[model samples]
Target: MSRIVYVNGRYLPYAQAGVHVEDRGFQFADGVYEVCEVRGGALVDEGPHLARLGRSLAELAIPEPMSMAALAHVMRETVRRNRVRDGLL
Candidate 1:
C-alpha cells in the first residue's frame, strides 16, 4: 500500500514531498504557522488555533495563505497522508 502526502498543491510520496524556497512563508516568513497535538489523530484546541491564525493575520495585515475552503481541503489531504486519526487538544 502507498500513502499520499499533501504538500503545496500536490499529493506526493513522503520521499518525494518537498517545499519550495520560493514559498512566501519560507521566503519572508510572511505566513502564520500552526502546530497541534494530534491525539488518536484528532485535532486539539482547534478553536484556539483558528483564533491564533486570525490574530496572526490581523497583526501582520497579511492575507491568509489559503482560503478557508482551500485550507480545509488541503488539511484533510495532509492528515489522510499522515494517517493521523486524532490530534492533541
Candidate 2:
C-alpha cells in the first residue's frame, strides 16, 4: 500500500511528491537540508535538528523552513505516517 505525506497543509499520496517549478531546492541548490533520525515514533534529537536547521538556513541565507511549532507538527506527523512506531527509540 502507498503511504500519505503531509506536505504544507495537504496529505498527499507518496507517488505525487510535487513542488512548484520554481522551488529553489532543485533550481539553484539554494536550500540547505538536514536528515533527522526517528526513534520510538518520535524524533531522536529534535533540539539539535532545529539548531542545525537554523544554522543551515543562516549559512545559505535562506528563510526559515517554517515556524518552530509548525515544523514540530509536521515532523511528528511524518514519523506517524511512515509507521515507525514499532521500531526503537
Candidate 3:
C-alpha cells in the first residue's frame, strides 16, 4: 500500500507530500507538536500529550493548527492507514 501522510488538511501519498516553504513550522521552527505512542491500534498517553501540546502552544503564543478533536481524528486515521499496531506518532 502507498504511504499516506496528512498535510495541511489533506492526506496524500508520501512521495507527493509537500508543505509551503513559508509555513512558519518549516521556515521558522515556530510550532508545537505532540508524539504519542501507539499500541494495539490505540494511542497511549494521548490526553497528556494533548494537554502538553495545549500548554506548549499557549506558552509559545502559537495558535493550534486544528482543534483537538480534529487532531485526534487525523492521528487515528494516520495510524490506521499505516497499519501500525505499535509505533510512535
Number of the top lDDT candidate: 3
TM for every model, in the order presented, reads 0.65, 0.81, 0.91
Ranking by TM-score: 3, 2, 1
Q: Write one digit per residue (lDDT tens) for candidate 2, span 1-89.
A: 57777765787898887887788776886776677777667788788887888888888788886887788788787678778764432
Please report the TM-score between candidate 2 and the true structure.
0.81
lDDT of each: 0.70, 0.75, 0.90
lDDT of 2 at 24: 75
Q: Write the per-residue lDDT of candidate 3 for residues 1-89, one digit (tens) a residue.
A: 88889998998989999989989888888877678999999999888888899899999999988898789889999999988899899
Off by over 4 Å in 1: 1-4, 85-89
**Comparing candidate 2 with candidate 3, which one achieves the higher TM-score?**
3
Best candidate according to TM-score: 3
Supply candidate 1's per-residue lDDT for 49: 70
Residues 1-89 of candidate 1: C-alpha lDDT, one tens digit per residue = 46667676778887898779888777887766677676665666656777787788889898776776676567666776678777532
